[model samples]
Target: MRSPNPRILYTALCLTGLSLATSVIAQDSNEEVSRIEQVIVSASREPETGLNLTLPWSRIDDDALKLTGAVHINQVMQRAPGAWISRGNGQESLVALRSPVLTGSGGCGAFYTAWDGISLRAPGFCNVNQLFDVNSEQAGAIEVIRGPGTAVYGANAVHGVINTLTADPRQGPEHGYAVEAGPNDYYRVRGEFRAEHGAHAVGVHFNGVSDGGYKDNAGFDQQKLTLRHDFSGEQWQVTNALEATNLNQETSGFIRGFEAYKDPNLKKVNPNPEAYRDSFALRAYSRWSRETGAGQLSITPYFRRTSMEFLQHFLPWQATEKNGQESLGLRLALSDSIESFSWSTGVDIDATRGWLREVQDDDFSPNQPAGVHYDYEVDALSAALYGQANWQLTSRLGLAAGLRLEQNSYDYDNQTDDGSACAPEASACRFFRPADREDDFSNGSINLGVTYALSDDHRIYLRGAQGFRPPQAAELYRLQSGQEVADLDSETITSVDLGLRGAMGGFSYDASVYSMQKSDVIFQDADRQNVSGAKTRHVGIEFSVYWTGESGWYAGIDGNIARHRYDSDANLLGSRLDIEGNDIDTAPRHFGSARLGRDTALKSGRSLTTELGWVHMGSYYLEPDNQHEYEGHELLNLRLALALGKGFSTTVRVSNLLDEDYAERADFGFGAYRYFVGQPRGVFLEFAYSPE
Candidate 1:
């Protein structure tokens, strides 16, 4: 499980043999090599053409999201391929796709996040740093589907799915603005607008940031907003969206011993300086499609609200929570075609009302109680019905299938006075409360696929899937110590994938290999009850590549090489040693990112671009009886842009560029070892304006 970094696997096998030898020398140079298809929309939710998608997809376009003006969101979701995201401190984060980076409370219900395709928190409430509540810094695209996207995304999509696409106003009039600055006292501002009139279109995007801490009193301030509207006639078409987010943080905990993120003054020490976090979110949606006759029909309606308060300060009795939620939803879809077979069907409905509160002002011991150790309220309902089909069995083969049926219910409602919050024999308390309850979960998902086509720029595929989630609501009413009713079950994953994808001349690639198995899997044992089967296994190889050589140069890579073990053998955390095939804590057998760029035009007309980036992290095992490890890190980044034509522009960025002392996350509980260090060598600058 530890091998990788043979000089980045020999530069990823010499850039996969130089993109298969320049795509067979540009198909024998008789010229003509422009294919360009690539289109995606969260698979099966509409737009398609990810080379006849049968699964494993990736996208992160929009000019790499404005040259990755990202300050987080793990810098554009690690450029896709088997994602990782990690990064904590400030805007916090944790997500691993194709599994493992998962943490408790249902481990964020096993991956599924969305903005344009809704679901940003509903299905039983999830939030492992809820992707900082959307706006993906004004996303234009960010699709990813690594594995098991729950038979077309229903209930948590088990091990993958991420959408976030917005910004489309008939692609017309536009306006932009930017300002940025970096290092500790950072600053940022961004804005965007789009317009169109004839059939109405409008868009707006926003951003805001303020940072100051590197550690000693961590800092953060954030904001995001999005609004969009579009309407087209001649047969109904409407789209509307609204998004908002806010965050105020000053949280930092973790900086313990062992390797202390390579020291440097304990990596900027910040021992929970009065930890904090505050959050807010809002969402709205409307999408209606047209052309119907039992065929192309779509409808969407949504709303969401969120609120949060933090300072759990990594526990040991530092409680202080507060949560919120309010939601309403609807989605319906139908598509049709017969002869060669094509089909689509959908239905989803959601409802939520949530609340939580925890408190502890002192009294850090006596079974760790202070007061109010949990007050709850929940009311969740989710429903789903899905279907998909495709067949083309000839023109080079194709076939696909899907199905989903889901239901989730939770009624909960206990505002104190359930079970242990201490006092009744103190020693057996550690905040357990669960009294009024009602839970239900019914799930199912399925998928199958096939694809052939060997020429016309490659294609080959195979897929199989199944995914599920349902057991969150704070993992069944937040219990602890004297547990109470958390006989959980729904958590599943089954997957298979094999692949090759295409595009020639200018080079493009997608590669895959997968295997997965996950079952019941819900933990907390070692007496803190709340359990479920527990099993895991995942295998992987993932890749993505791009090239655009004919002069202005470009290159890309995204990576993965995985393993996530522990299939059976448990005790949750009393560690009784012997973990089934180990390897799972912070799983990372390999990680990736790479890019190289060039563009020039100057001669007074203005244009220049330069880029270089590489990021890698491979070492793993920080627990799960694998005894502790974390020797991975690599980073370098640089960017520059210049264009001074009337619509002004400027950019410069340098992140960790060679100043590496890493650990953007690492841990090994209570017995020591922790981190979240990483972040050095900063440099940033930006200024922009647009009009053309």
Candidate 2:
């Protein structure tokens, strides 16, 4: 894999300009662009607006996102309530929604990330950095379902769900293009086109970015394209979406030592400069809807193909890992209204085939082998059925209940027997890979809620739900020397939530408190063996409030304060260790952000907007033992934009304005403290054009 050179990036920008010019030639047909509005979220699996939602949620509209200057998911998610998106090396991130910044092979399966209501990867093959597959930078809206999602989403919806939607073509015919340049020789080009003719509509988007990076040999280049089409008939409609993505990343491993992020020299040096990751994905899905006697019915069918290869620089013995998967899935649902109740039912099915291979190329210890350590293939099948009903119990009271049953099965085939050994040169080994095996799990989820409307603009609700997820393929197949087989159960959580949500005049607010208990938690023991059947507890309060006055001023604050702790004792090495009531690692107790901005009208139908934002994170333990902790930091950001005309705009953004040195992520493992250094103070300029 190779990063794009300066000349290539320049050529790419020039081609984008040519495309924009070509789109302008179709102006013979005059059209008026409609104003953008906040959309009702479909991820809720119900027909409800944000103001009427009983569950804790958040939405980032196009207007607020403009002031963010967001290039990464972390930048935008920070504005949401109880959400923490941490960035690693180039385009890599981990999400935390009412949970911790989960790590390890099992981390990716704890949250569900989707594009247009479709999962990025199959259940067992989830990538931790799956967000890179979606073009969120150009999305129409980003919806977040905090805590356990609706029953219709099924597995991997434990902590929360993120769904990104593409712009609708009905708002066209419209064309948009943007060019951005910033510190570290960064450059990006983006373009979009939407048009509608009679009953058919089409939308297309393209994005590309290249950066020289701040650390040595740490650079990346990425590109993505999405195409969508919609066709409507008298009583039936069909929508199709297709996307292709490619990424080449030169990864930078963490720097070791306490407070190492403050060292300017160390922050610029890449400890593992040879690390790189290259990946590609192609996904397509179609949704069909028709009017039925009972109500409206919809069916969706999807296909996915993805492949990736990366170097394991964090491990002492560097290994080259490769994996790929192909899947076919279908979802069906129906909704109708009864006398006083609204109900919906759905079913989901999926089948996938995948393979994984790992080989050690650089051995730092003589005890570790230098040959192929793992090679396997797996076939996975999953199915689920769910139903939900909402009833108006009284003039001002409502009740909602839902139930879901799901099953997952995996068939594994091991192609190598030398996966582990008592010695690196041993003739045979018996520790890591066991004989071919089949594992299956059956789980269920339940959701119940009650709501009372105190007035037209005030409401309160109570909700209790259960969520579960089956074990991931890596947790079962990626074996260490101490174990011959992994016997794990599905992780489950039970939570109770109480909240108030509503809009009054020019003010809107959402606040909630939740208590949860998780069973069968998966983790690595002191013996360095993977196991399940542990327990944990979580409790938190999160809220968001925004006020917009007629004086053109607006302000809002959103944040979460939480505690997560282990509630079980364990057998470590050989002796029993009492770890009850210990705080969970990487889970901060307090974190949130605030923003203040204003919009002013200028001369001749123009306007100017500016925003000032602040972010704060509290200190937290870096290890399960609760002996090591990281001191968190606060940050400030500024953004200013001017509308040049009806079709053009310009913006100036400054990040880390105080130039404070900090760590984006911190951890203690392998007998040392490691950190991913955060970016320093940087200035960026942006120019955009959107014709009406």
Candidate 3:
């Protein structure tokens, strides 16, 4: 194993610091320094901290968590604009996003996303096993990088980024723990008690969850443990986090394709579906930084290993996968403006290896046995250099520009029998070919955006950016002939965005319109000349407005309208798919939500905050050709909170208030789309006590 060339990274850091000190000087702080619980980024991954607004951006501090009850990260995300979700028996079935890309399946592309400055999207489908599905209670402050991000972040940042800032030792630096229980046989208990003594802080957090799901046998359980430490001094600061998480749950199935909506009770009797999933993961990271008047330069090294086992009980299959990654990077930040310009740059590299194996299993019984299972492995390496700059040409006008160049290489090799053919039944026969393919490619993406002050409370902006995603091995190679696929290209998209923001009568609002034409899309070809090839166009509008005057007395509305079309004409029900008229598959034409809340003061500083929220999704046609369609959906959520003292508070929330039935997601067959009930109007309550 080879480590990163720190000698070079360190040299760059020194040069960057010298340039910063010579070019720009730190300006005096003037704006009110408000410590807000929520931070909403302005199109960039950089969050705007200390913001108090009702514009779909809600900050949940420890007190608010206790007052507006929600414990899980997923539940809190639903409160955000464009937050949509659904769950399967495996607890892995839940997938939520803001206008994610898709094929016959779901979540094809991502926007700006980062977990402590590292990308979270794994190679495989970023489904259940991949999501950092930890309980929200363990987090310190959940920072939401709102709206589409065109900034310099990791791969998964298409829609936006939600960075969960874990807890530190500062809140108490002593022993403390939390436990809670609720209806539906729901039970969860987490404890985080830390200790600090003179420049050193060390803490441990343990979380466990298990609940009898609203539907029969739909519950799940997971236990996560973490050890965190931080050291602060005049010359150096160090932080470390080591985590281990394991998931164990029974297979849960939902009616989809045509089974659901037909028989609402399909959730009973286990549904006899061949769905199951299990995974274990360990992640560790260490960061060290030295303070320079210019800024703090840090080095981060991380390692992660994840193991997954999936069994299709209803079917004749069994499989297991293992993934590992080693990454090292350096960050040099300069917060001061150099003669009126600000900039930041860094370089990073990631090396990953993943493998999948098919186990011999027969669903029919011991009388039936399959022979000679196959194993596949892939090696991928990526290196990228990125930089961002903000130049204030004048006090009223600003310019932002960024670019990233990435070089990626992939190699996939597997065994023969590469599958005795894609046949349902066959005797021992070596009818497959061999696979030894490798490809290396490079690409560059750029972003240019400008923000101008229209007056005092109004601003206008114009932005353009490009996004891309490389197809995984499975999508590139599907057994054929005697040899496996060895050639494919990356998918890319270019977008043009127009936006407007202003405030009126204590109301702040923002709206944006964007159009994108994507090319090099991977698709299944008839001749097998290329397993992936297609084109698409997406156009949409997004708007949000909110207020921030009195506690509880607030309201906000937000939503989007999109039109997705397929290029390179095809047939929809025997007719050439009409690009100009056909609706994109699963891209809901409309998605909107609104919320209103106010605190009813019973006495001085003693009040109850009650909130009502509603979300609507426009009807979407199941197929791209628009042959069939699923009706749109609407959901309502209600919450209440009470604060008794400056340091104590409690909150409760009920989601899916209407118990609406709809599909959190949809694909083709084996899809799992159903009128699955929401979290059963879930009720979550939390209590908090703090000393400042």
Candidate 4:
């Protein structure tokens, strides 16, 4: 791998130090002092102030969500350090958190995604583009943990965790609505209603969107609905939530050639107009909690159903695949505190039934058949037991530790004739069907940390943790090149982090450095065989800082400098290559965003807010050989909002303000370069109304 870039690291460290120094100087000034403490729930599955948490995490609040008005989740996710949601054609994305943008059937298993503290999908049945199945567009808050979360979250928390919290009926206006319009014939409508009676409250939120897309024949229509009910009693509190989402999109395949995104005409062309994806998901859950003599007891049960159909345009055979899953799960927890010690313990249980089918219409070659490639069904069961505790040994020193044990089992049934799909005279087929079989995996994870308080508003912490993910169903059953069975071990990662976080005199900052090592990584070898026992290493420095002046001005910056490299010799593209120490493809060394804004109050109870944002993506190799590269790009964004008294407001946003040309993603595959052209400059306007 390439040597670490000192310039980039130095710049990020300087910014973080400046924010801390300014806080000290401002604290001594005569100006009014203000402090804010943000609350997060992803750390321990309970509301806790971020200032006191031992984890490295970030949150995007409702105010920021409203001001940004993101059509894509990537817009708001960029504000968090060490995070990158790689955007694809309309509503599709690949996630990278403290690691490279991993791709493949099992890549999505590295990160755990949830809604309202409930897992969105059952273990061993994850989809790479599953983020679109949630209603993040209208979430009350989005929280992200940058490193391993397995100790508290169980399996599939190898890289990190992201949780989207639903809007609470008691916190916002009673009735609200918004209408938005933008370039490319795009339109969206959003509405919400809340009602309270006695000790019961209900909230209904919904949104719909229609877009004419930037690339030819590439458009999408989507809808999302959420329902929340809450009941407060003397001894018990109950919260119920239901969420549903649907998406129908015409996808555009990658355009090939070097720097094709720079060509105006080529950038707008679609290579596969017939490529499309349709997906739907529904989830419901209820959480009940109360104070008890033993401890604070809580119980939660959830149900989920999801289905999807998409054309595999990236493959030469152009096969179509359909898949779905239905699951039921439950979570129970208890917590208590005595003296200077606090502790929590929990148990999780889940069961799911899933099925998949793939078919090709016409023959592409002798090795690629035209009939059904594979058809199979799987039943999965997962369970875990976990506990965590904290001890305040002294007024200034503390210690924390957690441990988890999880088991996952899968029962696979094949509905097709076993063996290769090609005829006997043909060479080994590219697709193979495995016989019916059963597989099971068990894994353990643990975390330990220590913290020391420097003063009333400052503290430092050091943490070490382990995480793991069982192989997905597809990776085991969807064999290739005559492989009869896949015997793969669970993937695991160990990470260590050192950090500091605090808030003082209207200034808040978080800075951390982390190193991680992964083992038993699953990937296809150069000879097209399923394999394991690979290894990789990751190291990075991440920071986020913000300053809000009493005069209604604020500035903030967040970013990371990191390197991801292979720790073992490997082969690539049918060639024997010594790839040890080489930088992983699509893994950028540095990327980040910065923002400057101010707010002013006008006469008649009106207000005005303006902000500008800068986003940077550093260069990285497009292939393992490190022979091809994509030079990075930067763009600017602007937003202005006007609040007209009496529950009326208007917002105008401009994306890609400088009209620069760039590619949202770049790749080298099939012996050619491919790019997903970024959208051109766009202007969006929205009008909203809410009654007081």
Candidate 5:
């Protein structure tokens, strides 16, 4: 119903033209310009360079991450285009990568999150609060693939993928330690060590944090450890990575009522004092590679174990739930070049066993007898076969295609009685257990693309892809009180993308436009029953630009204008609701960020950098009825960094520089509106030291 401001787009285009003109006039006809060096590994299974990957992708290197002194993933992901991360509290978040702030049990499964090369969780079981399991805070680099990923990845890559890469010692070794202090009695200590000897290398990273929360009865302390080892010979190599994390969090619940974020007193109140979350996770993976006659062979095996428990504060009935899983997986691949084509083929297999237990300890109103709500165990097996080929049809044209077939099976055993409601306290049972059953899903995906190089510094491409995801175990097993069983099918989304990206002189830019349609969408009805067979549509334009000046000044912008709406009408819990053409709840139509900064080198062997950033989120509906809307707000941030002699540096970060009072997340459910209060202006100071 609304469109972005035309003046903004005009201004950006004018700026791009001016930058191109400057590049042409500054160089002589005989002068040669070196192309920018770009390296990416997640777009494909192997290392590649430049923008010829035929997809929209981005990377945040270690240097940019260090300047922010960030403590959360949200802080570091700000520069990524067409992406958003909504922080619920200290370390909890909901991710939207070219989609809405997907909520509920199946929300987290939309985005495939991984560390190194393996996913953090199994396919059937994904925790909405899973990002805490990753060490992104200390990662050397973070790679993001927007829209549907390639066929090399399976299952939960419906929306996108985020891979955290471990630091390498061969890139030059340097050890560092840092300490930071901030408002609300926040304190953190971090350490890193790296060394290389001949063909062997090792790296270790550790961080611990303690925070006295701003809200009453809300605080947390957590720690993470990461270790990596790499050994290489003339024709073979072995690499191993290990990560462990422990967390103790006093989670916060939504503060009820409309415009609650504007109330100063309400922002400092914790409605659910009994809410807490505890979790421990361990992950390790190893890879072996060798050069063969046909091509290069690589095999990887990974293992993961995780346990977590938290109070369900969002529901009317207060319950405590615990869940854990252990899994083992293997991936083998081979890649080789023939003539003008490069091909890669791979197979992936994994097995997992997990359980869930929950009980109602308190009832908000009309108390029912305390009883078990859900108790079950699931054993799942998954396997996939995938292949991709890239061909250079001509000097200026390239073609790429990929395909994957996957199978997922679940064996569920109910530990509780199959019933319509919790027995003794039927009044308080918001969940029911189904009879033990076995379910299986077979899914496939195909992608095709073609790219043409317009010049030495410009390229254009078009892509079409189909992505799918099997039903999550929680969606099938965790049912509402009145529902006897959940009959749901796999969800799929088809997307078509067209765009241009390139680098000229000191400027780099990427622009894309795309449309998508999704089928068999699983969602909660008016009565809170989980069901499937709904449809939705997505369409958007994404743009990102950066310019580096010879005078040490830089400017960049990452923004998107998009629309997501219901595509069809369906029967919802005996109610004839016509939701066709309705805007998706919590999906903003206009959002983006801009940063202006400068870097300078001082005479005293020191370097200084300062940045001013702005973030914007447009208004959106809070209910499917479109009766309630949230007027989104904009915020400002500032950061200053100073690099001293002897590998020592200091950073000062100021969040909410304008002190805009807003909600980090908002929703209307069960006849009430809720919000997670946003933070006020706060300042943090960090100091680091490393030996040369």
Candidate 6:
């Protein structure tokens, strides 16, 4: 049952009006209307040999995504199969695709996450779960690229890319907002405006949300502001943006799971396992292009700076945490195909700086020890050069190839001195001399692929590529623990991909199958050694379909299943893994999602749309002993929406429609029992208004 909040109740009432307005204006008389008159998607790379390929790259139009009733950009990305989101009991989240990054730790910080080419990755040890200005509000569309773009995107592009394209400037007045309040006293309100004056345009978005924890120590509150401006003249265009978010949230009490199940109402040491962080970002992009008799040539340059603070244990051992990362990149592309070849080359560079500190507390154990302290700074720099070429072997055959070379270095200095366990105001503390280390590392790889046209409407592609991720910070630090050693070299992979794409009978299908092997697997072995072993291997395949034409019906299916095993002593697992065929912890062997929906005209001038979706996750092992398993689970969700003319719209969303309880991942405490809790069923009504 939803808590009755006046603010949320008012929002529902407003939504009802949008539903009525859309219905009154939803006559087929304007069925010919189109939201976009022109589409330009080549921003990712220069035209490939198969410029005509119709691949099913998953995309969510802002209008449709808003109906999901999700406030986070990462949350909306869940619509894509194979993509995984490991959310914390409260606000933090860890994400990765097929090749999972060891959750938490700065090294596993999502294999990669970026915005307009700027890496959203933070420099904190918790980098793996950065949640700053990367909000989902005011986005025009989100493009989820399924596989690795190493050849094209470089280092951070190890797994996948979720690019959030901001909205374009509107030519007229616009005012739209939606408010939502639900069962947990969770409420959010967002609105924005955009306008264009000749060659100049400006837009802004503001949003805020609050929710009381369903359990002890679990409430959350957040606010965000985003702004953008664009200007163009002749053959050049320029754009700038700033996004900031201030989030203060407490530990929405854990599900109270311990080794020895205790009292139904047990009070933990940290009454509030609370954490709060502020994220700020500034970025700019400028591009210049001109038509050439040979083809089209364009040059783009980008710069960004982000700062974030994570109060490690804001509610308990709380101490201030600070992190900042900056990046600058420039690229030039000349698009032109001779009688048989087309080529493009780009160069990018990024540098990162980080800092960490342990704030001491005396509450629980104020007893004996240094009060608080902070560490020096650690910095890293990475640079890369890449080139891509495509050859038209003939009118029906094409070849594409690319190679990227990269180098990075790391330095840490100025350690904090241990206060003489007895000092006045902790002053006069000795400062450890700075110790710095630098290493030269480089990686080079190539991607070779081809497209064969079977006819005018069908094509087949066979792509095989090799790429790798360098040893991260954690792998190196683990050396001090006297456990697993080190992987002095780059962790690499070589995989084969087969794809088929075509457009026929108002239907389009783009499918692919991939089998990849991680050479010199860089995984923490059973002995906790970060050594090179034949174990870390990833093999998987995926299929996606999208269709929308004269039928007024839209349907999409996306799913993937991956099987992995390390070279171990286990005879039970076919891969000969050490655990005797026992799969890795937390890796779901089977996971998939499907969406079915239709678009139809309603009475009056409004339109009605309904959607059904299902998600399935296979069971996984929870403990190394393999005695217990986190059972598998399935979920069903539904949403219905009405679109009114202008920016007015309404939607009803039901999540966890089946009311099932299952853990997406396990976070066992020091206790013995397996602790887990799944999200309960939730429902919400949404409303919005936007006009051109």
Task: Report lDDT per candidate.
Answer: 0.83, 0.80, 0.56, 0.88, 0.83, 0.57
The deviation in Å at residue 484 for candidate 1 is 19
Residue-wise C-alpha lDDT for candidate 5, range 314-426, written one tens digit per residue: 76677789999999999999999899899999999999998899887755443333567789999999999999999999989999999999999999999988875445644
Best prediction by TM-score? 4
TM-score of each: 0.34, 0.92, 0.80, 0.96, 0.94, 0.80
In terms of lDDT, model 6 sits at: 0.57
Q: Over the stretch 1-692, how does candidate 2's per-residue lDDT look in tens digits?
A: 22234234333433443343334433321110110013455544544655555677777866666568686789888888888888898888887788988888888787888888788989878889999988887777788887777778777888888887776777643788989999898898988898888889999989899988888899899998999999998987988999889999999999999989998879989999999999999999999989899788989999999999999888867889999999999999898888878888999999999889987865545456677777888999999999987898998898888899999999999988734633656543323765689999999999998889888667799999888889999888877655778899999989899998765445566789999898998887766677998888999999876655554666667787799888887653222346688788889887877777788999987888988887777678887777788888778899899898878899999999888788889988777899999999989899999985
lDDT tens digits, residues 1-692, model 3? 22233333323433443343223223222111222223554333344422222122333355444444454444455445444433445455343344533432214344333345455444322433354444345666555543334435545444455555556666753654445566777777666678888999888877787877656655667888877899998888888877777777666554555535434565344553344466677767777777578764666677666676766453434432333333333443333347867666666666777665555544333323354345667777767777777787787687878887777777777754553443554343222434567777676777887877677556677777776666654554434333345366676777777777655444555666777776776554433233444676777776665554433365556566677677656433223356444666666776666667776887767778888876666666666556656565666788877767665656667777766555555444333344343444566665644432
Worst-scoring 10-residue span by lDDT in model 5: 27-36
Model 3, CA-based lDDT: 0.56
Candidate 6: tens digits of C-alpha lDDT, residues 208-307: 8887755555667888777778877676556766666666766433343542112334422234455555555566566666666756666667666666
Count backbone clashes in candidate 6: 31
Q: What TM-score would you give candidate 4 relative to the actual structure? A: 0.96
Of candidates 5 and 4, the better by TM-score: 4
What's the true lDDT of residue 444 in model 4?
Answer: 95
Off by over 4 Å in 4: 1-36, 573-576
Question: Residue 436 deviation, candidate 3, in Å?
Answer: 2.6
